[model samples]
Structure formats: C-alpha cells, structure tokens
Target: MEGLKECVANLVVYLHPSKAKCPNEAILTELSSMLFTYNETFEGVVLAYDPGNCSNLAKILPGIHPYFGVKLTARILLFNPKPDMLLEGEVVKITPHSIHAVVLGFSAAVIADEDIRGEFKYKSKHGKEVYVSKSHKKHKIKVGTILRFVVKSFDEEILHLSGSLLADHSGCARWLDKNSDKWSQADRF
Candidate 1:
C-alpha cells in the first residue's frame, strides 16, 4: 500500500481536538444546506488506522522512536441516508489504484404514482457495460441477489473521501456534535 505521507498527517493535524482553527461558518452553512436538502443528518466523527500512513511508518520506525510508529488516525463522517442502498454481506471489491468498486447483490425500486416499477442493473467494473432489464421478466431479482455494481471511488477527484465508507458511517454524527460544542444554539446559521 502507498503510504499516506502528507495526506494522513495533514488530516490528523486538521482534525486535532486541541486545534482552534476550524471550518468557518459559511462553510458549515453550506454543508448544513446540502444535508438538509438530502434529508440526511450529520453524524459524529470516527478515528481509524490510516492504511496509507501505515506504510510510511514502516520505513521511518527504525530511525524514530518505536512508540511513534502507531497507526495514524483518519476522521470520517456518517450519513443517515446512506450514499446508496446497500445490503449487508454485499461484496464490495475495490480495484487497486482506481476509485471504483464492484458491488454485488443490489436492487433498486422505482416508485411511480399508483405503480411500483423495480429496475435492476449490474455493473462489475468501472467503464464497463451495465446489464439492465431488457424484459420485464428479467428484472425479477431475489432479495439477496449479488448484483454487480461499479461505485464511485472515494478517492475520486470530486468525492475526495477522507476514509473508508464504513468509517464515515460510524463516526460522522459524533464528530459533528463534538466539534460544534462551542457554538450557541442559535448558531444554526
């Protein structure tokens, strides 16, 4: 794994609890606006071992104090409305050096007024052809079918994820509350 020499370190520095510098109100306002529109609530933050930084530690540990080699932590947020509807045990296979993954056993429901149409699509790799319903009868998928998927990579230029999806889902709510402790109740602006 490529060690996160600067990126992880920078994230740790930015999320440090003792740090006084934080995102400005304007940025927070924008985030709140986006969250509200999406019908999702901001969750707390979670600290986890950064895989990238762990590589760097291996090379530097001999010269530095052994105690300094502990895994570095990265912060992530959790969202109420999952970025996508994913079922447990869904196989998520990530392509190395790419920001996309293949998800298996997934189905989506398209609800139209007075009628519900269930559409199924499966894509196993990025840039690959997606298999969709050619006939209505072909769309019948079991509840736990392993459907192929190509999810946007977290490290994509636009997504720029700080950590893994699981990490974000675990920590986002807590981080929001803890970081907002200094704000007054009326600071929702």
Candidate 2:
C-alpha cells in the first residue's frame, strides 16, 4: 500500500487496419495488455487503468498496411517499491533460513536469514514453525501473519522483492499497531 501511486497519462494507441471499424475496442485491448506488467516508461507495475477522453480524428500511417493512431488520456495505478521503504505483506511460507510473503496480494517477497534481526528467534512448536521476538514475546511472525519489512532490493523483471526485518519499525504489523507507544519508546533508545 505504501508504494501504490496513481497518475494520469496521455497516450497514443496504434490500431491495425482490420480494427479500424472498432477503434475504441482496439484501444481498450491495447491498454489491457499493459496491466500486471512492469513498464519502464511508467517506472512501475500497472495495476488498473481508466481510459478517458479519446479524439474522434485519427492519423493513418501511409504504409503498406495502414495503421491508425488514437490519442487518449488514462489514469493508472502503479506499485513502485524503493529501497529502505517500509512495506507490509502477508506471510505465505516460513523456513529456518527465510520467510516468503506476498505484497498487495501480487508481488512476492522474501526475508532471508541474514536480514532477520537478532531479537527474533526461529521456533517450532507442535509442528508449526514461527519467528518469535525474544524482546517482545507477543510479537510473532508465522504463516498468514501480516509482516512489516524494509525493502532491500526489488527485481522488476519478476516482481520479486528482498526485504529485511532489521529495523525497529519492521515486524508484525498487528503487534506494532497495538504497541505503538511502547515501540516508539524503544525507538528512542
């Protein structure tokens, strides 16, 4: 949620000659192709889009196969994560060496052993594996838990993220919210 941003874009969509009869539909299909994929021009993954006004007049290219360009405006939502940014994700898997999570129900994230701070200890009880904070017993991270972590690196090609729980503000989101006062006090020292 922290990295989600919405912005307006003015774009020109080129439609093939066959789709000249239905230019609007062709434009919609072209915009749909951009969803859920990382675009360098946008600098993030496109989540959703709303196409705005379209010009009735189109410019047709003077080539063997005529292609027409339709100009339109659109609002798009993007997920752009940056280093040292705090993010929240749901834990999907856990191991002694790492924790796997999904951010915003789409992007994948992994918190490796070296990135986990010393305060949290990996434990197994009744066949369930979890990371429990030694400093605060109530703070725990297990499968299905919502975790807050700092972004170490992000792979745009695969939408994979490497995260860290080394910061005081990074941990179990529920625990952090419940103990906000106590957490702030700890941050002071």
Candidate 3:
C-alpha cells in the first residue's frame, strides 16, 4: 500500500486523448498547449501538476457538469550524455598534474591544465615545488568562479575533462549568473 501511494504521487493527468473533442476551438488550443508543454519539457517524462479547479470549464461550457477528478499521463525521459559536451563545475581539489572537479552530481573528473584558465602555477615549501592554481592557493574555489570544461571521455560514469581548448580564456566563461544562458535555474539547483 505504501508503494501504491508513492506511485500515485508521481502521476500526472494528460488533458487530451485521441478522438477527444470540445466545442470551443479556443479551449481545445489551451488544452493542447498544456499537453505539448509536458511533452517537450520533460523530454517524455511522466510528472504531475496542479492546475486550479476547473470552475472555468463549467463557465465556458453551458452545462451543470463539474470535473470530479483529473488524470494525467506522460512518458519517462532517458538520460543521454554526449561527448564534447561543455559544462560548468566547481574546483573540488587540485593535484600535481590534474584538477578534480564535481559536475552534475558526480565526481572523479580530471581537468586538463590547458582547459583551466583561472589556475595559476606556483611553487611552495622547502625547495619541494608544489603546483597550485589561483583557486587552489586560496584553498577554496571562490564563489561566482564557474569552472568550465569539455568532455574528453566519459566511460563508466567517469568523465575526463580537458582544459587544452580552454587555455586562452577563450573557452572558460565568467560568472554563470551573467555569462551563461545554457544552464537553467532548474538545472542548477
């Protein structure tokens, strides 16, 4: 019964069905618009939304009929990551030859030195040279500094990021709030 309730919580009602029709074309268009939004936004994923009670439906149509219940249907979207994909992440850690970053809720990334424009190399300690980027020297990635990288290889959920193409600051962009438009608020949080 608990599982059943969980499943019901995720359900959405599809407004339109095949062979369904309404007298008003305008109302039909609105329904179609809602349906199309669900289809495209989720890439065919099933979800739920609470549109206010259909009191308007009673007004538009000349009937005492009222919608007692609503049911929606949608398909699930699949996960698909592509090569050479550009993404922004945070500087989680820095190593001698590589930088580790976390992107899209996962980790184990190795950023190529050439791709990181913000990183500055410097030596530290008792003649034992230690290389650290600008952020690494501070021991923390500064807020608003969005690290950008290209997907060199993704295998078994591990991504190899390259900074080679980003060497000239040509690839890396500034703060995401002002510089980027690709990642939406929903995608970020």
Residue 59 in candidate 2, Cα distance off native in Å: 0.7
* C-alpha TM-scores of all predictions: 0.19, 0.97, 0.36
Q: What lDDT does model 1 reach?
A: 0.26
Q: How are the candidates ranked when ordered by lDDT, highest leading?
A: 2, 3, 1
Give the per-residue lDDT of model 3 (tens digit) for 3-68. Answer: 001111233232333313542343334444543122333432122333332322322223354322
**Tens digit per residue, CA lDDT, model 1, 131-165:** 23323323322223332221222332222222222
Q: Which candidate is the best by lDDT?
A: 2
Q: Which has the better TM-score: candidate 1, or candidate 3?
A: 3
Off by over 4 Å in 3: 1-79, 113-145, 157-189
Best candidate according to TM-score = 2
How many pairs collide in each candidate, listed in order?
18, 0, 9
Cα lDDT of all candidates, in order? 0.26, 0.94, 0.40
Better of 1 and 2 by lDDT: 2
Off by over 4 Å in 1: 1-73, 77-135, 147-189
